[model samples]
Target: MKKLLKNIKLVLFFAGLVLVVFLANCGLTPLTIEVPSVVNANEVATFILNCGTEPRIANTDPPYTSKLIVGFMVPKSWKAAQNTTVELISSEKGNSTLVLIPSAEKEAASGLAWPDAAKKRFGIGPNLLDDFEWLVYRSVPAYTFINNEDIKFKVKISSKVGSENSFSRLGFFILSAKENLRPEDTDYTKYAFSNNFSVTNGEGDLVDYVNPQLAKVEPVKSLDNDFISLNFDAGIIETTLSNTDEIFLEARGFTKSGQQIAITTKVDKTRLKPLGGKKYRIDIWPRGLLNVPQNETLDRFEYYFTNAAGNAKVGYGNTADPFRYTFKCP
Candidate 1:
């Protein structure tokens, strides 16, 4: 019985030693993240990150601490607002510092690229913005120990108004001891985490960015056989236009036999002035300006208009209710 007890004791001792070694070898703790449930487009938002383990510089000639790099992935339809900036604040100290996140490719290229080990571990390739899909990363010197520290950061994001819809998912990443770390390092994965948060509208009204509305179209009297006058009620132009900007009118004529002909005419800014109230008018001469054959037009007309930005008003056709008019040769 005594010998058996000794053998059991030796086995227990060896197992405890092994467990201690394993714990000591494990360098980093898993990272934790928190983000807001909803964020507005073209607004600044806050995200929180907690670094589990203290970051340290492995080897330095002068014994200086390395850098902590934070990365963000902005979707293709989103853009970093002009003068977009980030502020990192330490939760414990309430101390904050300004960090610049570069939107330009020329500036971004100057940063360190992820090493092969990091790329393989995270399953990500070279980070680059494709078609306005931006990946912004910024690094700050790890001057203070950030073990289990909650770091709060503010980010400003703007939507490519017309390209983005009601929602977009943004990705985030963190790398500790970035200056001394390589992508291929065995510990790279341990000190990093990648996750995503979504930005969505709370009320769910996705406003149209550049849609122009055509309110009314009136066929003013045909001026002789050479020209036709049309009064266009182009409802409130929401977008501000420069002096050089132009609006175009598209007119389609259908004959009694159903043969269709179309022509486009440019309406200068001078003709698009306000008519008394909120309504605006544009006098168009589609026949003479577009060279539409006057002899072939026997029946109906369709009208559509567009601004210089390609924002078009809904097309009007012969089947339109209440105000539909059929052209008759007089």
Candidate 2:
């Protein structure tokens, strides 16, 4: 009985040791995340993140100084720096404004800039589209967290929507400069992604980044200087071009002054690149595709998809009228 008791004690001791190591290794812990699912562009959307750092077992005997960084994976149209505000609240230091940092500033621990460091640590955070951008911010007056003290940081984000109706799984990443999240240490760098968020009461077609769509445009917001992609997903919806194996683009561009330039988009020059599962896409440069002169700027486009050898054609909502896109850089 004595020997059996000794064995049991040893097993329990090892289990407790493992548990302690796990807790000691924990770095940044996000306690609660409150995010909105859908919001109006005309209104302000708010979200909160309650986070803490584990009281270190030993090296924490000395106070550590570091700035906390938060990155937002948001729609480019939001102009997050101009429209979003980040506030950091700490019981020890009161509330302070978290200001946006230029993406080019390099982190001491990592050779890359904060944005590039974050991208290397976490890429896009499960967002499907490439139109999103990362807006990085740092808490003001680099804070020194005391040793063996229980401190919590509350981050509040208020975002104002831009003039586009769209959906995206917004991403947030939090980390401290003290723990720049090298490859071996994974605890401090934490990523939190919101649900399929939406912004309505804006302009143009619904630029959906969350789910599959029948037709869509890339870069949600772009000017003629930016190259844009037109996508067609025939499998998601039963359109006139559903069974058409070969698809071609037919489009017309209009200038700001209403001068029309018809693009010769129906030939092999305008063929869409086929992606499996009945989807296709074609990238176009506005001025080049329309053969526009340097003096005139293209403003919008009307486009359609048609079968290579048949009369089957598809337009907006699979109708006869062409699908329209109004170009606005904002």
Candidate 3:
């Protein structure tokens, strides 16, 4: 018995219980959220989360101090963790820089990384697409909530957006350090979403996460070394290809050294694969399709759809002008 007791490790269950109880009494409520509806890509945009914590009577002298764990749901392409910075201003704790949580820490409830766990719980919020990630951070030192006094906090997020002209619903999460994202203790956690945040000044095709599109380029941004796909749905609008039994891609790739290469000859190589419902797509290697020299770089591609015989053509928005796709990946 003595040997067993010596080998056994001791745990402080009471301290843990006290912290949980204190969190149950305190509540985080959002007063206002300020985030721009539209911002240029690669520019620093500011988001302010204004909230207040409810007052609660202290069970112990220290009142169960805790550090704030905050998370933001953003586009994966933005690489927010590396491109963003966070600051916290509180009525109680003064000012402090919010530090990113270590990547190795697992969420207590989900047994996954903090960012992945957040995605599993709240998801992509109100956005229609699923190409976003959660970036989590925590406040330095700990905060001690005072009894009978509401504590207010302002979290400022400065992030440099990615180089994609896309829109998404940004999400914000707040909770105490020990609370995490516990399923049973969900009430202690708080979250809010922005309304269709958009990026206007970006390169290549517009990636709208808010709605379904009729035409799109696979790998929205790519270079000559990448395999590209042009996808279109003829039924979405009345076009020359909408009535044609067979559709073909008519494209001209421009080389950096001022050379025009045409990939549209209405041959077997240019035919689009039909996916029923008037949907069609064709995959192509930019370098191979244009027969471009490795020494030369591609500038962009002007393209359109054609009938089987190559007479009728459909361009941007069913206009006579050809649709253009720029090779603008960095």
Question: Against the true structure, whose lDDT is highest?
Answer: 3
Clashes per candidate, residues 3 or more apart or on different chains: 3, 0, 0
For each candidate, give its TM-score against the true structure: 0.38, 0.82, 0.71
lDDT of each: 0.42, 0.78, 0.81
Candidates sorted by lDDT, best first: 3, 2, 1
Q: What would the per-residue lDDT of candidate 1 be over residues 166-194, giving only the tens digit for each residue? A: 33334445554443334444432233322
All-Cα superposition RMSD per candidate: 17.8, 3.6, 8.8
Across residues 1-330, which tens digit of lDDT does each residue of candidate 2 receive? 999999999999999998788676566776466888888876788888888776454455456777888777787778777888999888886788888887667866668877666667666676666677777888877876654556778889898877788888887878876776576665777778888888888877777787775678886667777899999888877887877678988888889888998864467668888999898999988888788898998888898888885387788877898888888866
Predicted candidate 1: what Cα RMSD to the true structure?
17.8
- Report the number of backbone clashes for model 2: 0
Candidate 2 CA-lDDT value: 0.78
Best by TM-score: 2
Candidate 2: worst-modelled 10 consecutive residues by lDDT: 54-63
Rank order by TM-score, top first?
A: 2, 3, 1
